[model samples]
Target: MNLLEEFKKNPGFVYRIGTDYYYIGKWICKPCTDEAVTDCHAMYEMCIQAKEPANAALYFQKLRAYSEFALDIPYNPAKILQYQTALVEALSDADIQSLTDQLRHFHDQAS
Candidate 1:
């Protein structure tokens, strides 16, 4: 099933910003996209914009899933590797740009 179909099957929580809905499972129709990656990226954007330490920590924790999710490599290395590969490729060009901008702003603030 596609992301939208998966979302329809299970109605998860929604986060809204103005008119935009950041609900990964529901609105996004991208067939190749992984739901976890989309959800993490969405939370990352919101956390960066909010400029709160707590949210920053949350985003960091979310990012750490890339490592945590791979901990079962001893049993099924190939499956985990494929998942990691897909997760790494899940970010779109716009997502990369937004992440870059957020990092730049953070650096500027630090300096």
Candidate 2:
């Protein structure tokens, strides 16, 4: 199912920011453009804007999936590979970004 649909399974958690819908514990939908708000961009804008440890961890989880997608791109106009490396380093065991809580229930479910 789509990300929005997935979020629908659990109500009252999805956060709507401008035209996009950020599933607090899931992902951020692409900006609306007169079309349906579909396709959960693996790397969300919130991920870039995350600050708090709990929220960062949530966004970080999404970043992990994004990092994988980044490595699969063919043309690579978005420099996703660089982003992938940076995220990996930041979320590494060395605590480069200093991740503390796992963000399991910070915003949404453990997933």
Candidate 3:
């Protein structure tokens, strides 16, 4: 099967294809997108497994922390921009797109 198909089955495997994006295999992106996706999914799962409100609160704390670090918004804007710029500079178009997709997912899942 094609990489797109694979990604459709499992979004955690998003990868680059020339200038395009495809979700297919194992790739852990700590920059902004994939890492965010992974963390968001983890949070969702934790929420699902939460036996008490305290556990869910812990997951929200973690989610907020991850998002803050990744987006770099509300704490030293210059530093956050630098961090995000470095990642964007190093990424291919495909990576950026995939990251964007994952980021959107992260946003939805986070809330």
Task: Tell me the tens digit of each residue's lDDT in model 1 across 62-100.
Answer: 544432443332444345345434533565666545434
Please give the CA lDDT of all the candidate structures: 0.42, 0.33, 0.43
State the lDDT of candidate 2 residue by residue for 1-111, as single tens digits.
122233323322223333343322222222223222223332233443454446545554554454333333244423533442443343445332222222223233334
lDDT of 3 by residue, 1-111 (tens): 222223223323322323343222122223334555455545544564564445555654555454334432243534533543454567677765756555444344446
Report RMSD for candidate 2: 13.3
Cα RMSD of predicted structure 3: 11.6
lDDT of 3 at 35: 59
* Model 2 alpha-carbon drift over 4 Å, by segment: 1-51, 73-111
Better of 1 and 3 by lDDT: 3
Order of quality (TM-score): 3, 1, 2
Tell me the TM-score of each prediction against the true structure. Answer: 0.35, 0.22, 0.37
Relative to the unseen true structure, what is the C-alpha lDDT of residue 58 in candidate 3, on a scale of 0 to 100? Answer: 60
Clashing pairs in 1: none
Which runs in model 1 stand beyond 4 Å of their true positions? 1-32, 67-99, 102-111
Q: State the local distance difference test value for candidate 1.
A: 0.42
What's the lDDT of the predicted structure labeled candidate 2? 0.33
